[model samples]
Target: MSILIALKQQTDFTSTEQRIGHYILAHLNQLPTVLIKDLAAKTYTSHSAIIRLAQKLGFHGFRDFQRALTTEIVTQEQQAATVDANFPFSASDSVTTISQKMASLTINAIQTAQQQLDTTQLAPAADLLARANRIFIFSQGDSQLRARSFQNKLVKINRFALIAEEYADEAWNAANLTSKDCALIISYAGTTKIHQQFVAYFYEHKVPVIVLTGNPQSPLIDQATYHLLTVQDEYNFAKIGTFASQAAFEYVLDSLFAVMYAQDFHNHLQDLQQKQQLIQNGPLTTK
Candidate 1:
């Protein structure tokens, strides 16, 4: 469980400790660098009471608590920016205001994804994709659009991808895949029945499955060979749009493409330049 979630659910604390917790929650952006003395002074509590609050939340002390809190704060900085993922802008805002809010939301979402993903998971995920005989992406709706974008990027490196769910032929595509292939599943909620069936098939067949999802407790998490989690601030089905989720998906997919390209950096670059040259100055009418 995330420390942030635990902190929010705590119900048993002394008055002084409660005050300290409330202050930290209210000023999350500044809590990382805040001194214990200053925090206690602001909360009107003693330093010992603040330490007790941290310990109650399962940290060793104030410093330990602050460290974990900082990791979760990467996404919570939205609070400081006043950008709500569900409703970033009011209806009364001007045209430019909505545009600016979206720009900031995109940056925040990518930053959250970066904090959530680590090299330990990305390196192996890219390696699996690079070595797979074929890559199939499983997604639908907005996530399907992101999958198509990733499919296009992979082609530049000579890695072809198929949309497994395209044209309602998902069952046919699944039946055709073998253990040598890799399945890349993209979903925000990760609870669809069809996706679960896909995961089960891949798991039983010894095929590699790479799951990208925001839900940590998703049913699709257990059997995946590589679980790449990227949580955004978007709600389950009630938001202006999938602004944060799609941006995070693009960043994760781009990161995988970059790492795979670097595996054969010189050769990929040479191939790309050669292709550009032929397309630009070929004997056939280029345009």
Candidate 2:
């Protein structure tokens, strides 16, 4: 786990420790240079409390923790300067400025998603999708669009996929899912009641489930057999659109598709060549 994530998800911290951790999280830019005594005074704790938190983080002392945090800050501070995910542009902005801001926002979102990935989980998720007899995507709203695009890519690679909720057939799809099938769920908040119920059903049936989500505290995370994450700082209902979350989702999907392709790289290339020839010469050709 990254230091930041560990801090965000700290569950076993004592009351004093939680205050210190919360302070550090809220003031990350200042934490690197904050003295232990100063932090203690600010959080109404003592220097020993700070040292204890540092030790829990596996650092020898407060200074070591600061040094590690400083290193993380140096590498992880590269966000788009003026682009906001919620409202990336305004009516006053020219067309060129709008286009450029959108591009920068996308680049920053994708880069941040990459930083949040737990690479060890990636390969296993790909393997689950590859080995499943069938793949079903469980998503709704704008996220379903990303799932559809992913479904199309899988089709190209000769791996068929189904959007489980297409035409409101979620229950039907869930009823038909077997242990041999795999579920790929995409949700930003990951708190939908129906999804929770469906995941429980999949769990009871011993089906493999993979969820790609932005929320760190999502209960779906614990239910998943394998998972991928694309955490982005975007609101659920207040955003202009699902710009940052969608970009992050696209990055993760593209990565998974690339990995699945690499698993049979030579065979996929040959298949592509054959498909190209068929498109060129077969009666279905448009050229």
Question: TM-score winner among the candidates?
Answer: 2
lDDT of 1 at 196: 98
Task: Provide the TM-score for each candidate, comma-separated.
Answer: 0.78, 0.84
111-186 per-residue lDDT for model 1 (tens digits)? 7787667567788999999999999999999999999999999999999999999999999999888999999999
State each model's C-alpha RMSD to the native: 6.4, 3.6
Rate residue 36 of model 1 by lDDT.
93
lDDT of 2 by residue, 48-126 (tens): 9999988997799989989988876665565635577889999999999999999988998887788777667788899
Superposition error at 219 for model 1 (Å): 1.1
The per-residue C-alpha lDDT of model 1 at residue 32 equals 78
lDDT for 245 (candidate 2)? 93
Q: Model 2 segments beyond 4 Å from truth?
A: 11-23, 34-68, 71-81, 282-284
